[model samples]
Structure formats: structure tokens, C-alpha cells
Target: MRPKLQIACDHNDLAAALEDIKNVGDVVDIIEAGTILMLQEGRQVVECFRALYPEKIIVADTKCADAGTTVARNCATAGADYMTCICSATIPTMKAANAEIDEIQVELYGDWTYEQAQQWLDAGISQAIYHQSRDALLAGETWGEKDLTKVKKLVEMGFRVSVTGGLNTETLALFEGVDVYTFIAGRAITKAENPKQAAMDFQAEIKRIWG
Candidate 1:
């Protein structure tokens, strides 16, 4: 299956998110109410995205560390199709969050083992996000063999994996044959002078490689 494009509306400004979405929403497959946005504007940001794009997939990047059920319920009630939890959270916490939404994505950031991942899958969770942390990116990191190795292993383990952090057209080519369920872009599209064209460029590249 072809990979999907997801826009990360991670900035703190709702209006800015809306502006970028207005220009690129029709092309992207998912709209993420990013962590910063969720923090700054609350789930109201997710609600606002839903109000405008009723048919679109919205992810609340809540990174829930505790109170899983309540946080997941709140996000789902606010119109999130998916919510995220940090990988280090207890299995019970992740399972509790998974119970309230369509799906709960395990955000892979720090350290976690395949054993823990198996626990998540056994608990009815299926999605995982492999990220190159923003701080790491800022400190000069890029996706490479180590990332691909883990991503492939995750796919083989029945995970619908999403790769995020510093993704762009050039970086995307690195995963040409990998079955990434979604490729998340933040400033790559939102900060572009022409958001729509930026989205189109991503779609064009995705189709070129995945088709």
C-alpha cells in the first residue's frame, strides 16, 4: 500500500495551523494537532480542525504519560481519531488509553525494547511512531540505517509505523521501499512559502516512490 502524508500542526498558533491547513488540507491524509498546539490551545484545537475537515483523520499528539483513560477520552471526545502515548508509560496506561480511542500510537522517543513493544501489541495497540527527536535534530542528527533497521523490524512485528521529525522530500527517499503507514511533516510544509505546493511536492514524491 502507498504511504500517506500527514501534516504536523505543531506550532502554538491555531490560526497559523488553520492557514497552513486551508492551503494543504485537501492533499494531506492526516492532520495532527501537535503537542505544542494541544498544550497551547488545548483539545479545542483538535475540535477546531474537526469542525473544518469533518472527514479528515486527526491525531492528538497528547503523549499521555498518566491518567491514560481520561486523557484519551478527553481527546476522543474532542474529535481525535487517534491519540499518542509515550513508549515509557506502563502497559496498563497505554492499554487504558487504547480503550478509549480508535487507536493509540506508541511514540518511540527515548528507550524501549521489542519486549515492551510486544506488550503493547498484546494489549491491542497496533500503531507506533519512530521519531528523531527535535532536540536531536537541533543537535545535528539525521535518519539512517539504524532507524530503518528498527522501522523494518517494527513493521514485521505487526505495527503500522509512522516516521516523524525533520522529514522532507530528500529525507523521504531514504525509506523508499519501507512500509511507512504515514510520513509526518512539520515545518517542511507549514513553513513553506507555498504550503499547497509543498504538500503537492510531498505527494508527488510519495507517489513516485510508493507507486
Candidate 2:
């Protein structure tokens, strides 16, 4: 099966987000109202996206560190199909989030180990997002063998994995052999000259590698 394409709208502007969605919505399986967008707009962003395109998967990238249940319920009511929580969250937080929605996705920053991942999987958190830090990338690092290695290990640990962090046309090819549940592209798609064609390009490559 082809890896799902996720478009990340990381900015605060709703008009820009809607424009990108209008152009690329057909090829996108998941639309992530990114952390910035969520914080700035709250449920309004999620509700707006849900109302406009009911068929697409809407993810609330809350990156919840605590008070998981409250956050999860709010996002769900706002029309999120999935919600994100950081792995550093306490067991109670994780469980609370999972209770509200079956599809809680744990975002893995550099701090988490495989043992912690197992605990999350045991808690019924079935999805994992291997996120590359924007700060690190800005400091001049690049995604390479370590990303592939970690992604494969996360899969072995029993979490459906997704990856993000400055992914674009050229860099995305690096993960070809690794199985990913979803590929998240923020500026690469949303900032493109032609958003729909950009999405199609990513989808084409994803199908070639993972289909």
C-alpha cells in the first residue's frame, strides 16, 4: 500500500492553509493543523478543515505533554481523526488520551528510547511519529542513515510509524526502503508554486517506493 500523504499547515494564517488545501486536498490523506496553527486558532482550525473537507483525515498536532484527556476530547470534538502526544507524557496522561481516541499518535523526540516505546504500545498507543527537530535541521544537520535505522527499529517495536521534519522532493527519496505509515510535508507542499502538483509529486514517489 502507498504511504499516506500528510500536509502540515504550520503557520497561523487560515487563508493560506485553506488555499493549499483547495489545491492539494484531493491527494492528501491527512491534513495536520500543525502545532503553531493549533495554538493560534485552537479548535477553530480543526473545525474549519473538517467542515470544508469531511473526507480527509484531520490530525490535531497538539503534541500534548500533559492533561491528555482534556486535550484529546477537545480536539476530537473539534473534528480531529487523530491527535498527537509527546512520549515524555506520564503514563496517566497517555492512558487518558488513549481512552478518548483509539488513534493516539506518540511523537518521538530524541529523548525517548525503545523501552519507553514498548510501554506506550502496551498502553494501546498504536501510532508513532519519528519527528526530526527543526532546531537541529536549522543548525545544519540532515536526515540520513540514523533516520532510516530509527524508523525500522520503531516498526519492530510495534508502532505504525510516520516521519516529518523538512521533508521535500529530494530528501524524501532517502527513506525509500523503510516502511512508513505516513509522510508529512509542511512547507514543501503548502509553500509550493503549485500545491496540487507538488502533492502529486510526493504521492507519486511514495507509491513507487511503498505501494
The 0-to-1 C-alpha lDDT of every candidate, in the order given, reads 0.94, 0.87
Off by over 4 Å in 1: none
**TM of each candidate vs. truth:** 0.98, 0.96
Per-residue alpha-carbon lDDT of candidate 1 for residues 177-205, written as tens digits (9 for 90 to 100): 89999999989998888989999999999
| Top candidate, metric lDDT | 1
Q: Model 1 misses residue 153 by how many Å?
A: 0.5
Show where candidate 2 strays beyond 4 Å.
none
Model 2 lDDT-worst window of ten: 11-20
- Against the true structure, candidate 1 reaches a TM-score of 0.98
Clashing pairs in 2: none
